[model samples]
Target: MTTSTTRQPIHTSPINLTFLGTASAQPSSTRNHSALTLRLGSDAWLFDCGEATQHQIQKSAVKMGRIEKIFITHTHGDHIFGLLPLMAACLNGAGGTVDGADDPRTQVNLNDSPMEIYGPLGTRAYIRNGLIYTHTLLGRPYVVHELRFPGDPQDGDFTHLPPHRSESPNGRNIPLKTDLNDTGTWRNIYSDNVLSVSAAPILHSVPCVGYVVNEASVPGKIDPTKYIPDIKRTKTPMSVMRRLQEGEDVELSDGTVLSGPPRRPGRKIVVLGDTYDPSPVASLAQGADLLVHEATNAHLPGIDPATKETDTYESVQERAISRGHSTPQMAGKFATLIDAKKLILNHFSARYPGDDDVNEEARKIMEGIRDMASFEYDGPVLCARDLMSEDVVLQQDNR
Candidate 1:
């Protein structure tokens, strides 16, 4: 139940991911469900808010007010049961007035801005019904955006669509579509000055998507030695130093020109929902710094007599595929195909006794991935647990 308020690293380049819940369909004694928070800069983005997610958040250090955007992978109860409750809590703290003014512990300012929720077609209706049934009056306005592919030929390419703004049924202004480019791979779903999010359709029981959050590349660190040969002797004006730090070329009075350093690539993290097929995920998460994928089962390809008393490995895999879920081995192979730097497997089946069993199962999957792939992958394979937080560092190419 450790909070992430002070756990994030001091470095701003790397984003921090906190696993609020890691169980799949069923809740376990240790794991709650599927929910994760990505802290970038001062804001936080949530992926897949599951049952009792608000409780999980309360036990952790993530601020409800900092969650500006929520991206639900699908309509499954395990992935979205906490959406309405969390929204309500954000507007009005657990013990506060509707406007959150009565609660002394409420951290979020009620007048800041409305939270934007993005999901599949039924997202808007789902939120509406939840509010109606619960008699929840939103103290502040909230917007629910449903993702849709345009039918027109010109707008067919999801990557080229412009940001579409429209009013929601609740009279909130919501952006229908986000800014995109002509990548023809994944569709850009949202973007701001700091981060850009993209999504790709993946095969699943319901309309599901995997999101990619790419932090915008930042200016590289300035090499003072390259610009200022003699630090103690060089008497540069304060304005010239400021210009150089801002990545601008500066000319001194003596006609010396110093060029700015190149930009450094930002970090990329991919969070996917339930899916049997991993091809779309691999494409969207190519070379991602971190890949957070669901490992709902530990099914192997062939039948294993050891597990035949209850279910064979082959039978378990069959069920997983039939139900549109991924086994740990499948998730590992997908991460290998995409060459992800690190693979954090979560959404574990409640059948696993504890983290030890989960890690052992993941190890077997990683071994399989190494054997199948041509290149050997020695990257870290983390078995995600509830409340486990990890820093997603940018892998700088020093070579």
Candidate 2:
């Protein structure tokens, strides 16, 4: 007689990040472009989708149907161009019922809901024009909502747009009108039971902002023995159990009182998208479990042979003003100043093939900063790879 075995599905704790397109510009055969996916339990959020971002998603661990939220940093082609393909994939690629599937969570309506998008400005028009032309709305209505920080919307479309420069006084919405109406104000972009997102104004030729997504504070796990029930031994009721777990007073059936919840481990993660060289961004990501910054070029100050003109060089600071880009050094220092737990340099320039130069130069800068920062802030520093996944945990099992 032979016995057969069934493979049980593994449960993975901690959220993960899948790098869809790490390149800063257009998608080449070797590199896709700038796109990232944040996995929060069953929900995945997209941060900037450039050309071929959907392709990258297809090649990675992310399921097109799982991503319900997309947050675009700015409306650059390298950032928002992939919205169509990603949307199509979600419409046609996922949430279909399988014959023998038995996962209990798949029976819910959220399992089939379309994506929810959030961005700076012009996002609604951009998506509507692109999707409407292609007839991309298939089974569900994928909603794209705009995020208006404290200051923005100089055009005075506050309901749909951000605030305005006229609102601040010596201020108002933003400062000038270039990128996001040149408003120098920031806001929290995304949030839920597990995580929260915040935005920061960065220097750029166009309106650009960096995002910071943080893991939310987690409540302590409760001890099952504490909720022990007698008589029928059916255990504690969910409402009373919830209140007790929250460390609040709860009344039992017999008028007995319960208090306190045992504590458990917790962690936080942050991602910094494309922006010019700025210090406040680092502070925004301070004490983060992870920091993903854009490294568009290998910055060394006048070491170029590509183009002899001023338009040829693209540093993190100058690019934000001239061509709107960021260099490796700027990214490294920003992560260092904020004292991030982990620094992940991303958004590579298409100038170098295979992204070899960016890795070498960016590593050197981070190493130098670690030596000079005058704190024992030695932690993991990674150079993100296209279509790769990063598991960001609040605490490691061994730790």
Candidate 3:
């Protein structure tokens, strides 16, 4: 099912995936580069910040001010060019100005909480250079956490890169850290009270990684009317209801004990970077509710010679492998392997005429895989477009 790309309605589901931009390598008339936002409760976690991502957010329902964390896949320009601008916009109160003025004298404090950024090695350098050249400073400093796989290049080991020429010597530089963990292990990168984020290295041209966002399981709804008819007739105290909602057994004055409903498993959403092979994401994305994978190209019938706009020298599969990208078929197989309930194909090539073409091709490939393996995966294969939003509904299954 597809919907308009204007705004996503408020949903009861705990997690939501909003595709800010879905183009690959470059922007097109209808599609932007790679960028998406995972809205968990009131806060937002951005996956990538490709070119014009801030503009895309402005067009969608996602609030830039709520983006507390950003995860970059690689250093490619298409994937990260818009990051600094977005940061600047966030610092400017999402209006591109501080205190409603562009003048530095009227700059107002913004971003009360420090924004955390996660990416592979060289992320620090990239952000440092962008901030330096742009002359952008935040009222509340941000932090950059660099994620690296085993044996990756190690640069200068400062905990955090200091600000470039501090104007208000009082303004603190954002803390930085190099989180180097064993390769192929899903290491906990960040966590809060409501959600936990983990990352694992994926097959990309650069030191890229995939991230999984796991929301904390919540206790199912408890109805006092069903458990205790006397309490419902007399109206139980709010405190007693709160205790039951907190998953604690409560006893009323009548000496009758009431137990809360069982706690259901939380939802899992996986966002994969550009990868030619999907094997790396298998273990990390097992049984995910939503899998956002890149589909750079489809297995088109004929190869048109290289034009000024398109690459000419290699076949679709050859180009995908050599450039560390994935085809639609590869993405479908990966989703099948991971048992993702729903698949959202993103980062489409500009060559595709429309979303229907991309969705059809991917579905055909997925169907082929199911037939070959004698298994069935009937989940939706959505072709993501800029500003498209999907609500991730958690399954109640015990599996």
The candidate scoring highest on TM-score is: 1
- Runs of candidate 1 exceeding 4 Å displacement: 1-13, 93-112, 149-186, 230-234, 238-242, 281-283, 300-306, 309-315, 355-377
Candidates in order: C-alpha RMSD to true structure? 7.5, 11.6, 7.4
Largest lDDT belongs to which candidate? Answer: 3
* TM-score of candidate 3 to 2 decimals: 0.76
> Model 1, poorest ten-residue lDDT window?
1-10
Ranking under lDDT, best-scoring first? 3, 1, 2
Which digits, one per residue and each the tens of the lDDT, describe model 3 over residues 1-399? Answer: 011123232224557789888888878777888899988767788998999999999999999889977999888999999998888777552222234357663444433346777787777668777676555655555666676556755445332656432222222221223345433655556655556777777888887878887766666666767755756755766667766776778777767788878766678888998888767657767988888888786543332122234543256658788888877667777888888888887787776433444566544443432232222346677777678789887665723
Candidate 2: TM-score? Answer: 0.66
In angstroms, how far off is 36's CA in candidate 3?
A: 0.8
Error of 3 at 89 (Å): 1.3
Once superposed on the true structure, which residue ranges of model 3 sit more than 4 Å away at CA?
Answer: 1-14, 93-112, 153-162, 165-183, 221-226, 229-239, 252-256, 302-315, 354-376
Taking the tens digit of each residue's C-alpha lDDT, what string does model 2 give over 123-221?
666766655445343444455555454454644323443321111111112222235542343434444444566666565655566777755445465
Model 1 gets an lDDT of 0.68
Off by over 4 Å in 2: 1-12, 92-114, 149-189, 220-266, 280-283, 299-321, 355-377, 396-399
Model 1 residue pairs with clashes: 3-61
Considering TM-score, where higher is better, how would the candidates rank from best to worst?
1, 3, 2
- Tens digit per residue, CA lDDT, model 1, 296-384: 77643442222446675578778888989877667777887888888887787776433444566644543443332213345677777
Q: Each candidate: what lDDT?
A: 0.68, 0.59, 0.69
Better model by lDDT: candidate 2 vs candidate 3: 3
